[model samples]
Target: MIKDMQDLRKLAYNRQLVSNNRLVLPEQVSALESYRVLEKPIYELIIDDLKTTSWTVDELSRRYGIAKEDIREPLLIAMRDPVLVAEGFVPRRVGRAQRNGKGSNVQYTLLPIPIEARIFDITLGLSLLHFDTLLVQHVDQLQFIPHDEGLDAFREIVAEYWSIRGDKVDQFISKQDVNCVLSALGPLFIPNDGGIYDRIRNKLFEEEKLLVPRFTRKKINKDIKKIRRKFSEGFFDLTDVHSTVIALSDLTRFCKYSNRMSEHAELLKISEDFFYSLFIQVHETVPVPASDADALTNDISEVSIGAGQSGTRDKEGTTAMSWEAPKCPVDGTIAEFYTVITSETAKITEKQNALRCLRKHLHAPGVFDLAICSLTTSANTNIQKEAIKLLAQLGDERAVEPLINVYGRVGATLSVEVIHALGSIGSHEAVPFLLEVLDQKRFENRIAAIKALGQIRDPRAVPVLIRCLLEPKGEIQRCATIALGDIGDTVAGPALIKLLHNPRSVIRVEAIRALVKLKYTEAIPVLQQLLGGDRSKAVRDEAVRSLKSLSMV
Candidate 1:
């Protein structure tokens, strides 16, 4: 038996015939990684046979049906460093281990490999989202029945983006192509047949209804549930899922797939049952309301801020509730502060600075719409942005409705800022608008929406934020990880633990941090595993910190 290095050297090399060439160790095998071999069923059986308990060589042979010689190297592995063997093993170093026959009932225990291993992870290298995007386009391109302008415009949008990036439309997309799409989209795009797919369908439909003749909405809608379910099953053959459902896609489903969505019930938002997917349609024009001139002028007289000496102050407690001490760029008191912000001929910089000053100074709060209206309507882009920030800082529940109204009306940049402020304000009233922003395309905006939901830390948002983990973009996943932690709800515990197994170390680290903040006891075992088996020092240290925190709690 290979009890030591000398014994291993005496063993013959395992051989395989490859196209008339005898493939030898270190030649065909050196190109492979240790994790590759560990991910297979053979490793699973080996781990199950030897893990947590050691067995004599003769017993191992009886259990796994391996020859005595074959069991030698495995036995050597079980003794010296059983925990890491599943990651990869080299027969050269035997390390110090009890001899197979040194004692009766010699035992070996195998530790399971973490899915997020630095190497040898074959499972879902990238989120399924990456592959789904390409498949969606391929299916759309193959749709001959609806050769209308909407589909044409959608194709043009894809082609234009590829052309802009110098990527070719005809270029064959490889298995790795899915990851590229996810990177471009930001972290993850969770595919739920009910919400996202139907939204994609409507996005295509909306383009046809608004742009081309209303009569052009003549196409029949296909089964999104069937399409999504098939993709969920890892069906990559487009033809297999009934007309391109899985067509050339299904690399990895974003987030971990489960038999029961109930496990993550906390991640689902209210009214998301039939909501439209974010960023599905390829519409060129978003049709933002034509300038804010008319709306602002009509509301000025009715919208005076600081109308009352006893106006309500913001209820304090939440993170976004605190206000800075009032400052005056123009000079002395509240009156002067109000005058400069209200002045028409003031330089944009002065007005912006004045608004910034009033954000803290303007304490009177009944119907502050006049100030908010002035800022939102200001022709200068800088003034508008400053106004949005000031309104959010105003720290009143009333700001919710007005912000929600102007959500999509402003330009994209201002829209995202508004969304951020809504989250900062922390009100239930803002949830619907925030949910709307999440459902729309434009991941950058979606990210802002996510941060806002996290800031609010509302239980209603747990499920929605959980879904963000499935997005293909690692940064998005990182942000979601931070957000989940900020909420500090235990219901999200399992979802966060699942991320520890994600392939990306950065993401895995973020997940660990969030799990720590949540104080989830259930993660103890997983954290212990990472603490012992993780390859990266940073990850291992993070696991240690989390474990320490959990124990203290």
Candidate 2:
């Protein structure tokens, strides 16, 4: 059971958990856990009712036939919220005592929540699907309001939600969390549902009604501004910065591949350049590592990791990178540890430390091959994990088969890590084995497997991941949708378009992302229907995005 708002707020106010660095709520242990308390159907009812209007505690209980105690927590939750506090007010019973000793004493009326409150209610009620819908439902009303507070609030929500590094948002966890938001917003062209285009047109392109205003440049500039504001907010910290960078890197690719950047190529290029320098500067200013190891950005070992090819080249024919062997570090400690790892006298801790040294100092083939051999011989799980991480970062295809052979023999925890390594390696050679894992693996392992397959960008994996869409697990299905999008395979286009009708809003939203990724212009008519006609506002917003992704092209 979750705590009510007052208790949670009181705890935060008292600085109990606030002593720690990040001031996260108790519920948001993970990004995915945001709004997770609203998973109950009863909470949905309360939110829906609030969205339609607002209700006092007594009225909510009476109207829904639910006890106030039962509804109290969820309702407070809807109000307490994602950064900003809950809106709307419970009217104090003006006169609980009898008036003139006659008939009624007081009335308990619930005033409607402010616009920001409605946005929060819908967002908490819906999940990841709310960003686009929140705007569509309220943009028209925003114009009527006095200031940019509502628009600014919308921007903040977008930054908060998209900036998260979560499974539902990205197929692979980003090496950098910031990049996750970057990637999600990259190819993303959110259809301005409530005539935002009309408003922009009426404002900027008003004089020339006959001509299409060539608004792509304006859109790109707007994106740059929004991203810059998000940066100023400084959403990341040292702990999760890598994940943030990975997501941002993915966004750069996202803009590149979807070719929605066809018109806005400068956006991706400038962002990558700006963020690369900014990250390096921030990286320098941060605390030193426990060991005297090199900073991650300065490490040359990553040079070959994304080598070979980056999915399919966009129309720009982006340059392909060549892999080169890493030079052996001069320290000589790496070679000493490598030799000692297989020695009979070596303890498990020694071997684990050796693997760690190897990861830090050498990416040469001879030493890397030795790491995989440890997987079979070393019973120590810690040793195995370091070896896996080293081999994955080695960016060698040979590491794929050995990792696959060891995957099943290992425990579930290590197996998931193994699959993640395979994905990082980003080799097509791992696709077949990973697809098999999707079929044979259990729980998180299956999701990891699909994620790896997607990163490899092999066409063969497209249909297999699509088949995963039918699986009973909604989690897997969502993973499959994102995987298909990552592959960017044209073959997945029709299949994803078909999912537009899926009753599940998350699935439908993911399908739109996949279709946009594939750039299947053929789906435009269908998307228009959903944009104008879908029952779920969230799903409709996704449709608008898909349409925008194409129309902009």
Candidate 3:
């Protein structure tokens, strides 16, 4: 039997571990024996009072003979933090701390938190359902305080909360589950809850609005389930999983997919480009043996001994003949070692595939680095081609040097692919590299280089083309003159004016067109000389057309 009230109270406090309420084992019981003291009576009184009816801080403190300040902050914090209150706790505020009109003297009333804070609160709990109600209550209440700091704070909180729930929705997907996530995504679009934030969300989700359940869910459950099943069924493996996850991340904000899509996409992009690169670097820096020779020798010897003469018997008591089982060499264990190698390879592959999908979807920076690395490392030319194609699609300036570096390092076919990739990038950075390639003795690389420089359209390329134009080689000079026209820079105007007098009619025609592209009014007098002053009708006609194109009509 319990001796005193304090002892009975101690037993009750120990029994009421609110957070993790599972049956406690003897070890836990022993562990709790030394547990530090907490304000048990005060905590219990508050819980009991909350269960019966909502009570103001003053009323509760008066009822329990405890100070109001002693429980005010703790009660409020407990109600807000899920780890503390879980499902049952509710919080209410007392009469206005200030005296106002008649009804202002009302007792306890539930105080709704700001919608943004509510979104943030729900995010921490991993609950999306509360977002809509919180949004409906707080949308109009949100003040557009026109300060950058205030706006930033508002955007950051909303984005962060949206991002958290978005990720949860993406991690688990079913039509019903997605609908739930989408339904919970209501706060993202509600106006004045942060107008700028709503604009951003709406911009991303506008196209997806036509899909089923509209904005009712966080993500498209169908796509997620399909991708996840493919991953689990071995149809995807890690690479496929990485790619699908990356793709989802990239399209997350825009797709009818889960809210976390953006966060995941952003993460996958970083992992693929930065983390994967670092991982590969780590692997490279740490060497692994290519083969275990000693082990191989032992296995080979064992195999030879075991595989005694095919038809030869063992000795004495044995029958006429018996075949010994062959033993595999230790070196042959490379096949078995493949499992380990494949696992490592799979991890790297998954990281890269995910990055590639993210690069495609998000168009994030450093995507070119991943694509180029993929190209450089791939043994298969087709895979290299694919990487080059992706870099071209990205059309970023960062890709120019890497593509050129690959062209310089690889085989003829891969070199051509890289050159084409540069041409497709269409950035100013590729011009110098392309020009340098034009000076090379090889016809194939030179031709591709010339074609690429012509497509780039940077004025800086004009000097290089003019140098090529002066060369005695007919094809190179001809291509250079034509490229100068495509460059369409006024700087090329004077250079072309000097070229019109050249004996080559092709060069003369190209110069006229180049002048037209540059819109050089200074060349009109020089063109009239070519139009009729003893020049061929082809040159004359080309000059007239050039003049017309320049609006010198």
TM-score of each: 0.43, 0.44, 0.33
Kindly report which residue stretches of model 1 are placed more than 4 angstroms away from their true locations once superposed.
1-332, 360-370
Q: Count the backbone clashes (under 3 Å) in each candidate.
A: 30, 19, 17
Decide which is better by TM-score, 1 or 2.
2
Per-residue lDDT of 157-179 in model 3, one digit per residue for the tens?
A: 34443343543332322212111
Order by TM-score, highest first: 2, 1, 3
In model 2, what lDDT does residue 38 have?
23
**lDDT, residue 75, model 1:** 55
- After TM-score superposition, the amount by which residue 138's alpha carbon in candidate 3 deviates from its true location, in angstroms, is 75
The digit string of per-residue lDDT tens for model 2 on 426-537 reads: 9887776776666552456677878888788888988888888888767688889999999998888888888887877789988888888888888888888775445455
Candidate 2 wrongly placed segments (more than 4 Å): 1-333, 339-350, 362-366, 535-537
Better of 1 and 3 by TM-score: 1
List per-candidate RMSD values in Å.
19.9, 25.0, 32.5
